[model samples]
Target: MLVHVRSDGVNAKYNEELATECLVWINQVTGGSVNTAGDMDNFYEVLKDGTLLCQLVNSIQSGIVKKVNNSKMAFKCMENINAFLEAARQLGVPAQETFQTVDLWERQNLNSVVICLQSLGRKAGNYGKPSIGPKEAEKNERVFSEEKLKAGQTIIGLQMGSNKGANQSGINFGNTRHM
Candidate 1:
């Protein structure tokens, strides 16, 4: 796959073909085609993974979908009925429990953690841009002053710096007197 590394440090890409395919897939999945690309790539990933759990988690973290609160519960309730969490609960035990477990999991699975965090839908702080302008353009015009030299005045290389012409010949001209 041809990937263009962006100049900026952020790891984001704009793949033309993938986007088009995603749009088509979205139309096929949803009974009615949606207006935006938000759910398109997600639905595609769900097909690849054979489940919608991951996408659902992403939506929750992104704040696109909010979780309903349990009024009686002391702890903050999860907004969405995450299938992955349900599956884990159904299983005999959960591997992750303590803060250490969560920290270790985050370190190992950075991408998944990012998706989960985004599902929370918290408003992030703004890092504003600075007011800076472009530098002034340099003048290419050359300035030269005449100087007196002996009869054996020598001229070397072309005045204009052409890479091709310089390589072919050692020097353009030998000895010369002012015209």
Candidate 2:
């Protein structure tokens, strides 16, 4: 049977820890522009405008975000976020690892913002930049030979009822009835 589990939201404690870690990393990448040494508590508010995010992505890989909007106007700020995300994408950060503009702008899911930053950090090493958080995931794409593919097609998988000649010939289901 399938069951549905309700999720309230992200872990506040984990978000706090990750936000701190990302702040320190952003400071390191931005060369103290983020100020983790003193303003550690206001991680979200500090980055809510998306300027730091643009700076962070540019640090990871140069020339990605051509221009970061310094304006505090909401749409302009969201444009900064979009630029950062696009730069992260160019840096090979998967889209799934990034958050939407609303997630960061409206603070709907700060954890996702942290996650996206961590992803960008992980990808930093690819561009010979300083990195933080978990190491970036490696791509291990497998290629099969045509002969191997043909051989696989000829074989019946065990889950497909081969099971050493076992069969369900005698099985019976309940008779149809309106009870």
Which one wins on lDDT? Answer: 2
Show where candidate 1 strays beyond 4 Å: 1-11, 36-179
Per-model CA lDDT versus the true structure? 0.31, 0.77
Candidate 2 residue-wise lDDT, 17-89, digit = tens: 6777888888888786654522223765788788988888877767789998999998999999899888888
TM-score for predicted model 1 compared with the true structure: 0.20
User: For model 1, what is the alpha-carbon lDDT of residue 7?
Assistant: 40
Q: How close is candidate 2 to the true structure, as a TM-score?
A: 0.68
**Ten contiguous residues minimizing lDDT sum, candidate 2:** 1-10
C-alpha lDDT of residue 74 in model 2: 88
Q: How many backbone clashes does candidate 1 have?
A: 7
List TM-score per model, in order: 0.20, 0.68
lDDT at position 86, candidate 2: 86
